[model samples]
Target chain A: MIAPLVIFDLLLALTIVALAVAVLCLRDLFAMIVVFIIFGLVSALAWVRLSAPDVALAEAAIGTGVTGALLLKTLHHLRYVTGRLGQNAARGLTAMAPVPVAVLLANAAFCGLITLGLAVAFLGAPAAGPGFEGLVAQAMPQSGVEHSVTAVLLNFRAYDTLMEVVVLLAAVIAVWQIERGLSEAPAPVMGVVWQGFARLALPVIVVVGTYLLWVGAEAPGGAFQGGAMLAAVGLLLLLTRAYVPQPGHRGLARGAFVLGTAAFCAGGPSGGQRGPRGL
Target chain B: MLEGFGAILIAMGAVFFVAGTVGLLRFPDIFCRLHALTKADGLGLALIALGVALLAGTAGAAFRVALVWFFVAIASATCSHLIARYARHGAGGVP
Candidate 1:
């Protein structure tokens, strides 16, 4: 690597390590969570630098954006439920976060061993990895899509995709059962700027999501990325009190969850299952 | 000429990012830190996106890059607002 590029990589690696340690050491839950979000963003950039745009996008959007927001919401919710009024929400989490020194040291040792083993395996692996790439190339023409990743997920590995949808649906149902009721509507947002923002940004998000879905057939944007974007828009709407699906929409949510798996299963064979020659 | 312009834009973007990080570290309060990070980082990202767009060979690529910048800017700004509001006033039963 050029000197400057090597320095950039070194700085990025150092930043990532520093952020990771800081998050673990920080006593304040909110600060730790914020640091973790930035950590995810920096890590995504590293993935981009490594020429993995798909992973970069996934890490940026889902890893940082969605998960960070969700975790913050959950933490705040716990604080409220715990009656930790006037205290920083971080306090609630920290109370539950302490780990014994022995356990922490054990975890560090285990992680170090895993990292060393993975590094060794990586160095020993062949460049081509048993010609899976060659097989994918040979079958590319019959995969029903130009994008190899999309084709594998939606057509060739349809079973796994279907199962994933089922898992998500099951999780939703379990959450609903635990609550024994629907969540209450979030308080409406107040403020002219937020109102204006909601009116403007929601439609744009929808458009981007639809575009992602359309391009996904021939590009790196696929069901997961597109769907995640759509989910983000939904969360944004909820946050800004723009649109709230009625808790009564539980049935609709469940159906929407199943619809993807159902459509994929029903359409796979009919979509010319030329993928594997016999199917 | 266009490549040089793109490089300069990207360099400026990096500077803004550095400023944002510095403010995040040195700012006196949560709100100040949030403001610094959001405003500077958003501008930094938009500038970088514009730089990349300038180098794009096709309109589609440029459009996509612009779209990404727009989405991210909105997301960050909105999320900062959400967090600020939460910090200002505890929600639900926290009172």
Candidate 2:
């Protein structure tokens, strides 16, 4: 008899593949976004099953939650713009034209070849060998964190992490620049139920995010997951129009965006001075 | 004994989820579908969370599981309300 765990894994893999196919085949933009979100959630479950809770957290928060919200917002905007462009254009945009047969065939063949190559490579890979785990273990005493993942990310690879924060800051700036040119009408005020829900949930989310950041020194939680959770808070506020940033708070918002990079840069040099760490 | 009880609760939760999915697909209107889906899912998640909380080894873990249920319940309730309101009053409002 097949092990229950093995059956679960098989089912999860099948669900992921089926969701991928549904995402691609769905012509309705809204349905496609929903399928994509479901695909992300399933992939997050797969990550958890692989015993990578950190990746699972990141996948669920950033991959599914935030990305799904962004996609829905974009779809709402797209529909509004298309409606103004006339009924025929709206219909054309909503129901995407079918792809050419040759293009479809070529794309399918390319994807199939890539999939086959990856499967072969994965299957033919050698058994696990002695890796850097030993070295990391040896250096763990001096890494200043109980969690090996945290040590590696914030200490051993501090410069890399610092660069990642800087890149994120740059991306935020670019988005702000693009958005500044567009005149956004104020979002409608949400109903009492939504406002009440947000009020009750926001503090819980904030506490959870902070808990994740604090627990990162000893567990499968860290800055990425915490930051993603905080971003979700912002997204929620935007969605509900519960807390719009006034002009007076623009500087504060900008400062908050830069704070991560600033803190990383300040700590990176001092971290290097403390001791040599493993990669 | 606790594990067996937890398992039973989880199985019941799964049944609720399956029922919710069926109702979502089969219901003729958006309001009816949302009504079926949200109520079933909320109850399903609550049962599963309660079961898992009972199975958890520590009080902290159990509390966290309860917290998860809390957030999900609030989210689903808010979402169902919003969607229903929009369907009733927004553009292309349903009759």
Candidate 3:
């Protein structure tokens, strides 16, 4: 017999699927984006159910928080672009796209079959698998990091983690490069509420982000989690026009951007294969 | 008694979540939806966090739960404000 927790898991899984399909079906761009965020949150719940709090935390902070915010920002920008292009294009982009019925039906059927196949495979999977969890746990102490996840990512698999960080850095640099030469229009002055909120939240977010960084030695947090928290704080400041990046700091900003990757590379020789203690 | 109270708090929190989702789906406009969402979800999260904190095996675990709740609360409220502002200037439909 399934336990109450199992039932809850089933319901959570169902909710996630419902939200995902709702996001696909919703015509309103705003509603679809919001539902997509909800889907991310529910998937985070599923991660938690699987006893992976680190993934859950990352999914919430980055997957739901950053992705949703960026999507909303994109939607807003798209509206402005379409507005400039005139209403007809806006209508066509938002709601007036007329796809052939046969194509739509065929696409829907293809998606449905894929989903059914995935569901069948998921349900038929074995409950247990050969995994390196035991090996990781056994070696964790010697790996020098107190947290198993951290030990694996930064210690046992430092090369992979280092490469991942470099890839991310490169992606951000490319984005910055593409966004170069954009005119810096003056942002509107925020009224009292947003200003006050920013003043209150900025310090708290910074401290919390630092704490997450520090706690990576023993907890379900790390640079990724901390970075995402800081990104949220940055997003807030960006929205409020509170902390604008001045042109003078371009050199320092570029240096800081590469600092993490440089540090990881520098540590490779002095550190063990896994990573230096807690990295 | 304490465990019972914890369970009740969690149940209440779940109910609030349902209420918030209902409001989100049924609200007439974006502003109203944001209002319902921020308040209901915030309180619901608070209650759930408190209940989970109470059930935590250690003080540190309890503190962490509260910390997560606090972060989420501020984030939610700020996002609600931002979304409302975005909607205000005829960007998205204002409620």
Candidate 4:
């Protein structure tokens, strides 16, 4: 008999695969987005089951929460644009041509072959090897952080982390630029219940974000998780129209966007100087 | 004994969750579905959180679990309300 834990794992994996198929097959944009979000949440659970709470938190916050909201926003924009065009245009967009059976079979066969190959490769690999865990543990004292993951991310591999932050900054800037071209029609005011909830929850969200950032030195939390939490707060504010940006708010917003990259860059040289291979 | 009790509570919570899912699938309309889901799942989650907290056996862990339950309750309530409102009135206003 299969162990209960193994059965749970199998079910979770099946659910993820089913969600992926549903997301692809669902023609309705809203339904597809919802399925994708469910996929993210299920994957997050899988991560937790694999004993990777850090990844689970990140997946839940960024992959499911923020990305799902963004997709919904995109759908709203698409509807607006399509509505402006005509009903015919919207219908044309939705009425995509069905894929041929032969192509579908070919794709499935290819995917199966790839999966088989990966399974073989994984099975053929050595059961044990000198992995980075030992090296990380050896260097942990020098890294100055209790959490090995954070130590590796922020100290040993600071350059990679810095580059990631820079990329995020660039993406934010790009999005801002694109958004500037869009119509500045005021967002509809949410109901009083939502407004009240947002007001009550915003401060709590900030506190949680700060806690996540602080806990990274010793636990499964970090800048990415914290930033995603803050982003959720921003989404809430925008949804409620409680923190609408004026022309004067642009400077402050830009500064906040650049702060992470700036701090990383400033810290990089100092950290490098303390290392054995000083740059 | 506490662990066993916690396990039982968790099992009960799972039953409620199953009930909620069934209601979600079988309910006639969006509002009805939302009604079934929010009420059932909120209580289900609270029970689950309580079970986990009891299993944890630490004040700090229980507090954290309670905080998670609080946040999830707020989010679920607010989301259900918004969805029901949207279904009833549409995006712009009452049609």
Q: Candidate 1 — which residues are off by over 4 angstroms?
A: A1-3, A82-124, A127-131, A184-190, A245-247, A269-279, B27-46, B69-95
For model 1, report the TM-score of its A chain.
0.81
TM-score result, candidate 2:
0.85
lDDT of each: 0.73, 0.78, 0.76, 0.79
Going through the candidates in order, their DockQ values are: 0.25, 0.44, 0.24, 0.49
Error in Å for residue A5 of model 1: 2.4
Runs off by more than 4 Å, candidate 2: A81-125, A245-248, A268-279, B91-95
* Cα RMSDs, all models: 5.7, 5.2, 5.5, 5.5
RMSD of 2: 5.2
Model 2 Cα lDDT, one tens digit per residue, A1-279: 999999999999999999999998886677889999999999999999999898898899878887888888777666664344345544444454567999989998999999999999888877686867888889899988888888888888887877777676777777777766443644654577878888888888889877787788899888877777777787777766666657677787677556646666776422211100000
Model 3's DockQ?
Answer: 0.24
Report the TM-score of the second chain of model 4 against its true counterpart: 0.94
- Answer with 1 or 4, whichever has the higher TM-score: 4
Considering every candidate listed, which one attains the maximal DockQ?
4
Among all candidates shown, the one with the greatest TM-score = 4
Off by over 4 Å in 4: A81-130, A268-279
C-alpha lDDT of candidate 3 relative to the true structure:
0.76
lDDT by residue for model 1 (A1-279), tens: 479988999999999999999988887777888999999999999998897776787788778877888877666655554454446444533465468999989999999999999999989898756746678778888987787777787777788877776676666667667766434645634455567677888788678666666676777666666666777777777766666667677676566556655665687622211110000
The 10-residue segment with the lowest total lDDT in model 3 chain A:
A270-279
Models sorted by TM-score, best on top: 4, 2, 1, 3
Worst 10 residues of 2 chain A by lDDT: A270-279
lDDT of 4: 0.79
Better of 2 and 4 by TM-score: 4
- Please report, as a residue range, the 10-residue window in candidate 4 chain A with the lowest summed lDDT: A270-279
